[model samples]
Target: MQTITWQQFEQTDIRVGTIIEVTDFPEARKPAYKLMIDLGPLGIRKSSAQITSLYTKEELVGKQVLCVTNLGNKQIGKYISEVLVTGFEDGHQNIVLAQPASPVPNGSKLM
Candidate 1:
């Protein structure tokens, strides 16, 4: 693994945000959802998250999630992804979302 200094790692803006909207992304090569997250001071940012195999739209609403907000935008077909919703793979290969142990202020930075 490539090692990165703490200063380098600190450059990434990892923050908490609440998922405010979720929609089906039929254009994505993989099964995915288009999300609109409320990042407080950062405003709402859109993301194309591949968590469809594990999460339902109904279950994602108002869910606070960790996001890498400074990755810049990426275009997937016709969709523009603004942030990366953080998660990890489960034993079954399903994505399990990464979230705070308890609720903190929305847009709080991960220190």
Candidate 2:
């Protein structure tokens, strides 16, 4: 693995956010959902997450998740994703969201 200095790691803006809304994203090449995440002081941001394999929309709402907020916007067809929702791939290749161990304030930086 490549090693990096603390300043390099600190430059990555990963923060906690809550999934406030979710909707089907048929326009995406892969099966995914368009999410509205509430990042507290950062305000709401949009994301496209390919987590339909494991999570239902109802289960995602109000769920706190980790997000990479400095990635800039990615255009998925007509949709503009404002943040990169963080997750890890399961053994089955499904994504399991990266989240806090318990409830923490939204927009809290990962230290």
Candidate 3:
């Protein structure tokens, strides 16, 4: 594995955000959802998550999730993703969201 210095790791701003809205993204080549997330003091942000196989819109709403907030925007067709919703690929390659064991304040930085 490649080792990164503590400074390098700290430079990545991973924070918590709660999903506030969910919409279908038919324009994406892969099945995905357009999400509006509330990052507390950071305000609302948008993201595109391909976790449709394991999650539903109803389940995602109000769910606090980990996000990489400083990667900059990614353009997917016409949608601009402001943050990267973090997750891990399952054995089937389906994404399982990275989240806290219990609810934490939105925009809480990962330590």
Candidate 4:
């Protein structure tokens, strides 16, 4: 695998945010959710996450998740996703969200 320098890794702005809101996105080609995340100092940002296979809106609310905050906006249908909610692929290729083991303040950078 190709390797990256420490500086390059540090350049990635991965931060923690709390899921404050979730709504169904029927306009999306695939099943997805429109999320409003509270990133503390970074402010609340919107995103589209395809995690419906394993997560429900009720369970996601107030859940702290890791997000790539600097990845610029992504346009999906009428939605403009402002951040990237990060996750790993499960055995079935379903996304499993990445998060801190314990609670941390929102907008906390992954160190």
Worst ten-residue run, lDDT, model 2?
Answer: 85-94
Candidate ordering by lDDT (highest first): 2, 3, 4, 1
Worst lDDT run of 10 residues, candidate 4, spans 69-78
lDDT of 1: 0.95
Q: Please give each candidate's TM-score.
A: 0.97, 0.97, 0.98, 0.97
Estimate the lDDT of model 3: 0.96
Could you give candidate 4's per-residue lDDT for residues 7-94 as a string of tens digits?
9999899999999999999999989999999999999999999999999999999999999998899999989999999999999979
- Each model's lDDT comes to 0.95, 0.97, 0.96, 0.96
Query: How far does residue 64 in candidate 1 sit from its true spot (Å)?
Result: 0.4
Which of the two, 2 or 4, has more lDDT?
Answer: 2
Predicted model with the maximum TM-score: 3
User: Once superposed on the true structure, which residue ranges of model 3 sit more than 4 Å away at CA?
Assistant: none
Could you tell me how far off, in angstroms, the CA of residue 71 lies in candidate 2 after the best superposition? 1.0
RMSD of each predicted structure: 0.8, 0.7, 0.6, 0.7
lDDT over C-alpha atoms for residue 26 of model 4: 96
Model 1: per-residue lDDT, tens digit, 1-111?
Answer: 999999999999999999999999999999999999999999999998889988999999989999999999999999999999999989887899999999888999999
| Tens-digit per-residue lDDT, 1-111, candidate 2 | 999999999899999999999999999998999999999999999999999999999999999999999989999999999999999999898999999999999999999
Name the lDDT value of residue 96 in candidate 4: 99
CA error at residue 61 for candidate 4, angstroms: 0.4
Q: List the residue pairs that clash in candidate 1.
A: none
